[model samples]
Target: MNVTIVGGGVAGTLTANYLATRLRDEVRRKEIEITLISDRDKLLYEPGLLYLIFNRLEEKDILRDLKILLDPGVKFVFKRADKIDLENREIRLGDEKLSYDYLVIATGSRIVPEEIPGLTKTGHWFYNLDGAVRLRDEIAKFKGGKIVVSVMGVPHKCPVAPIEVTFLLHDFLKIHGIRKSSEIIYTYPINRVFLMESVSELVQNLFTEKGIETRTFFNPIEVDAEKREVLTLEGERERFDLLISIPPHKGSKVIIDSGISDDGWVPTDRYTLKVKGHDNAFAIGDTTDLPVSKAGSVAHFQAEVVAENISAEIKGLPPTARYFGKAMCFIETSFNEATYIWFDYETQPKFVKPNKFTHWMKIAYNRMFWLTARGVL
Candidate 1:
């Protein structure tokens, strides 16, 4: 059976690995083949992008080539996935197409800063590898400006990234001896500072303690680079000397183009990670509109569920595993300290106090993630 996974990101990669161990048992190894399709050759370690902005980590340190990451049981097609033909159960490329007995959509999402006026010219984003590199360089040259870290919309990748950026900027500026002149400001679309009320209140208190200014309910309508101002749809103007903006994010173009997305995100069952209206198709990770934070931890959690379901499907059994929207991530408060938060749909996020051990744990997790990609962790 040809099991095709359309994405080389965390979700697709993990699912493929899980299938390799399950379906590629010594006797059935010859019967099942896992094919992964993606445009990129390397998987960028997204969580480390924050460290990139501080010029502490190199691009190569965080990226793993698909060739090195994939198992021998998986065949990787290093090309763009152009289309998904639902009627024929095939995925299309420019000159070739692959028919799948089972398909998984984990193509992930893309940032569209250009969707907002003048945003590309006025701000630096740290979501993608290229953007992180650019932001790192830009942050270095900044000379005591009103650095505004703002979010364009919700359901963005790593929901806490903008907040983390704001925290890092405080330390970055202080280290450069410019904290006195540089004002760190943060803005979000909603009145609440974060998705959870308790976490939001705690974060707000921390921001207040640090003297970081906050502006809520400011969705970007336009960016004026020359005047260093951001105009909101509510006709509110927020001035900034340096803008580090998180632009509007949407699901991958291929997913949207294939008519499988509800406004750029594939709608999925919150508990099962199963795509709606499809019998053999499932989705995981940032590609799905799962109402969970679009972070790698969430993606990994979904992959575990999808992998179990795929194994059951291959064996003609019913799905026995389900996802519970579990997510936990280490919040890097400073160079020396980090905080870890763990939560699920039923549990409120519980965080460990920021300390050196948590920082080391996050670093250790980053290393383990690469091993996990190879099915060794």
Candidate 2:
């Protein structure tokens, strides 16, 4: 039996490792072959993008080459997938076509800055590697002007990223000795500052103590590149030296075109990670519209279930593993301190106090990137 996986992000790479190691016994017993295809040869460490954005980390330090992670039994196809042919149980990649008995689609979302007028041409984004690098260079040249960090829409990757960016900006200005001249403002579309009321209250309090301005219930309409202005729906005009914006995020057009996803995201059995309307197709990570944060931890958790289920099915046994919506994040408040929040669907988020242990833990996790690249982690 052959298994095909698409995407090389946290979901795909972690899943590959799990299946290759923990399920090696099953693979050898059942003669199962695994294949992973992706456009890039590297698995981007997204959480470290924040450090890259601030120029504290180098791009080379965070990028994990995928070739180093694939097991000998698993073949890696380096190409962009053009189409998903569900009828033939195959995937089209340019001139090449690959067939599989079981398919997993994990091609993640992208930031469509062009979706909003003048956004791509004017705004600075820090969600991806490229955007983070661009923002880093731009922030360095900034001579103390209004820096507005804003969100375009919801269902974005790493919901706390924008908040973290704002806090970092506050620290950045103070370090550069321009805190008085540079104005930092954070704006979002949500009614609350964060998804949870308790967390939102903490964020709002932090903003107040830091003297960073807050704007809620506001939607960005367009960016005036020539005039360096952001126009909102309420006709409010804000002049900005750098508009750090999170562009509108959407799922892969291929998933939408193939009619596998609703509004570009695949609707799956949240408990099983199985794509609806298909028995053999599964989805993991940001590709699925799960009621959880579209973060790496959630993707890793989902992959654990998907890998176990795939092993069970290969043995003609029922999938006994179930997925629970669990996600946690270490929100970096500053270089000196951070808070770790752990939560699930059944329980409210519990915030842990800032300490050196978490900072060291974060540092240790960053070091794991190198091991993960070599398929050791």
lDDT of each: 0.85, 0.83
Q: Which stretches of candidate 1 lie over 4 Å from their true place?
A: 26-28, 316-318
Score residue 109 of candidate 2 by CA lDDT: 80
Task: Evaluate residue 12 in candidate 2 and report its C-alpha lDDT on the 0 to 100 scale.
Answer: 83
For residues 1-377, what per-residue lDDT tens digits would candidate 2 score against the true structure? Answer: 78888888888887777677755875667687788888889888888888888888898878867887777656788988888887789998888888889888887787878888998898999888888898899988888979999898888899888988898889988999998998998888867778789889888988898989988886889999999888888767788888999888888777877777656788888888888877888888888988888888788778878888887888778889988888878887877778888887787887777677887787788877656534465
Q: TM-score per candidate, in order?
A: 0.97, 0.95
Clashes of each: 0, 0
Which sections of candidate 2 miss by over 4 Å?
25-30, 370-377
Q: State each model's C-alpha RMSD to the native.
A: 1.4, 1.8
- The candidate that achieves the highest lDDT relative to the unseen native structure: 1
For candidate 1, the 10 contiguous residues with the lowest summed lDDT are 21-30
Candidate 1 clashes between residue pairs 3 or more apart in a chain or in different chains:
none
